[model samples]
Target: MTEEIKIQAQILTNEVCQFTVDRPILPKRSAFFSQKEDAKGSPLPEALFAIDNVVAVLISGSVVKVTKTNDEQWMPIAKQIGAAIRKQIQSGQPLVAEEDVRRSASEIDLRKKVETILNNEINPLIAQHGGVVSLIDVRGADLYLQLGGGCQGCGMADVTLRQGIEASIRRALPEVEEVLDVTDHAAGTNPFYSPTKK
Candidate 1:
């Protein structure tokens, strides 16, 4: 007998709602889709794109993080998303097409590419603020990054990560599924920008 498709919703932020499935949905690498066209191989995200207000989809492990373009209530949209994902899983269709299987490059090569972009594009820009970003690890399609100096405890770090660093990585290397910041702000010795300051 097939396992029941059970889904639970957790709100990540005002705009992002995460739906967790009882079963695994995707591979270890997270697939981040900003637009419908970018969701080529994944049937789950394609179905999610059909929903009216979904602006982005991130399929990581058993969780599907959906970002809404509008500020609608999460309850209604979560229900719709839960049902859509359940339907797709029950149908037994391939979540990702065989032709679209993500090609894995050597970890060394991937790390080098990410570092080069950071050194050339991202690091130089953030350096002006006394911040430096280091590539911590490259596992599968995930890129773990460490932020130091000014970026460690800055109020704008999250914004910078989402808008600046992530966009740059995605634009440069489409295969990189996720760019995660692993900085421990509590240990930050010197923070260039403080949130409490007026």
Candidate 2:
């Protein structure tokens, strides 16, 4: 008998919900399946795409973020997703195939390079403003970052990311097509340029 897999679902947005299982699914690299073809050798994404209304599947750090096609309620869909993920895990299928791992090995190197630039170059520059930047994840040619400290909710955050950070990343790694800021500015505790500041 297959061991029962427990999953917890959390709504991230109106159309996106994150489902986490008790065990680690994908620890190192994240796999994104915007379509069934993208799933390829990954049993998890392929299983997830089989479900109705699951437009995309992103597995990273033991969590699967499922994006629905429309603004449907998450309660009903999340239940189905949770069950599917449980079944998929219990099947003992590989999360990512050996071939796929070899294919994405270069991306790991690229991610490390990006992290080095952030630590050595970008972070120091932002530190002067009482701010810091962190590399969240790298998907394909896109780099996701989170800005913290004084830069979190600052009005100049966008300008800094677009003109300064993005430019710097692009210059360093021309292969990186985009550098996106995933920081939640509204939740920022300390902003360098808050309008309410005296």
Candidate 3:
């Protein structure tokens, strides 16, 4: 029988400097970022750092990217973030609470708003990247989105989602709890390839 190799991963940065994993690592529910404080009542594990500093967490076969606050540096923290993720994977831990799969009233609204945004704003812009955003579903106030085409593996995908797409959605619809990208960031032709600036 042939042996199945465990997938390996690396970290990279976008134009906005947000860190993203070069490969996908599936995680479980109890597995969570060590940085989020408001997670006390939630089943998601507390991120090792704080929300302002966390970039994302691999939970339940997906990456839960965090929104950073204005006071932290992404470069100095990338190693720590990577180490934490490595340690968690080595330990085989869960990434979130099962209950987190349920949708909240606000989250439902956010999903609708996201659908509208995708149909109206995001899709048109990302068409340039040969990418598209589709609403998978919503759980609680969190909105799950799938990134397609060039956007799927583009190195700048995360930055575009967070800074441009997400910001636009939130501005148009403030009820959104959190925007989650469910795209397998590790797949697609030339995935995670960011264009260099002149």
Root-mean-square deviation (CA) per prediction: 10.2, 7.4, 12.8
After superposition, the stretches of candidate 2 with alpha carbons farther than 4 Å from their true spots are 101-139, 142-169, 177-198
lDDT of candidate 2 over 3-30, digit per residue (tens)? 7788889888887898888878877766
State each model's CA lDDT, in order. Answer: 0.81, 0.81, 0.57
For model 1, the run of ten residues with the poorest summed lDDT: 97-106
Residue 111 alpha-carbon offset, candidate 3, angstroms: 2.5
TM, every model? 0.53, 0.57, 0.43
Taking the tens digit of each residue's C-alpha lDDT, what string does model 1 give over 1-118? 8777889899987788989888888757555566787677679888998988888776767988899965688888888899899989998998755433353234546877988999
Specify the highest-TM-score model's number. 2
**Candidate 3, run of 10 with poorest lDDT:** 26-35
TM-score of 1: 0.53
Backbone clashes, each candidate: 0, 0, 23
For candidate 3, the lDDT comes to 0.57
The order by descending TM-score is 2, 1, 3
lDDT of 3 by residue, 108-180 (tens): 4455567887998889988876888877656556778888888887878888889988898788877677889
